[model samples]
Target: MRTAVCSGSFDPITLGHLDIIRRTAACFEQVWVCVSPNAEKKNQMFTPEQKLLLVKAAVAEYPNVRAELWPGLLADYAMDHGACAIVRGVRNATDWDVERELARINADLHPGLDTMLLPAAAEYEHFSSSMVREMIRYGQPLEKYLPAAAVELVRKMRTELNREEA
Candidate 1:
């Protein structure tokens, strides 16, 4: 089976992220939508467990797609799972550069591992996890940004978190 790992922080999965995941799923026999746990990301709107739940809800329709949490080298995780490719979303030049460098590192870590970059759909090109968090913080409606299945959970979580802070 040709498997691919689509790893990201996914504090709250955005439409842009879903677009990339859907595209990747169509290409690979199985795709893992991994909620990457990055120590550098100190301020996360949602916990890793929450992100995993949201990702699971968002990708429920894709029979071949599974959502989970992973920390450390993404390529190594892929290898352990028998995945041959690391799929990522490239929304702009900055994202492209970062993914490109990571691709290089992944290749070095495992020579046969391939990296596939999918362009964000035009409508979701400007959407990002940070932007979604900002919208949630300001109490903006998420219908346009978040995947339909996860909108309610994200909104509810943000509201609950905000209440706790109050």
Candidate 2:
């Protein structure tokens, strides 16, 4: 069976991420929502487990979709997981540039793997996990940018952050 790894930090697994996953699922036999473990976000708000939990909850209905965490080189992880393709979501020119570079490196590292970039849906074309976090941090509603489960998680996280602040 063809498998694609749609990996990302998934800090909170926003609606934009789901949009890509749902669309990409149609093209691949199986899609793994890999919870990317990046050193840059080591001290992140959400732990990898938390991120995986969120992703699992969000994709519970999709029998072909599974969520897991992987730390280190993405290409290496995809190879280990038997993913023949990497599904990425691109929102703009900058994302295109970044994904292109990543694709080049991944392809060089794993000759058998391919990378596919899907542009974000029009309504959520501008949405991002970071943007969703920023909006929630500033007390802005993100009903459109986040799923219902994510909305609850964001609210809980906000309360926790407020408690820590106070």
Top-lDDT candidate index: 1
lDDT of 1 by residue, 1-166 (tens): 9999999999889998999999999999999887888888766878889999999999999999998888767887999889999999888999999999989999999999999888889999999888888888888989999999999988778778879999
For each candidate, the alpha-carbon lDDT, in order, equals 0.90, 0.85
- Cα deviation of 56 in candidate 2 (Å)? 1.4
Alpha carbon lDDT at 84, candidate 2: 93
- Which regions of candidate 2 are displaced past 4 Å? 41-43
TM-scores for the candidates: 0.95, 0.90
Which sections of candidate 1 miss by over 4 Å?
A: none
Model 1 TM: 0.95
User: Model 2 over residues 1-166: C-alpha lDDT tens digits?
Assistant: 8999898998878888998999878888998888987777643667777788888988887888988888778899889879999999999999999999999999999997999999988888788777777877688887887777777776786698789899
- For this target, which candidate reaches the highest TM-score against the unseen true structure? 1
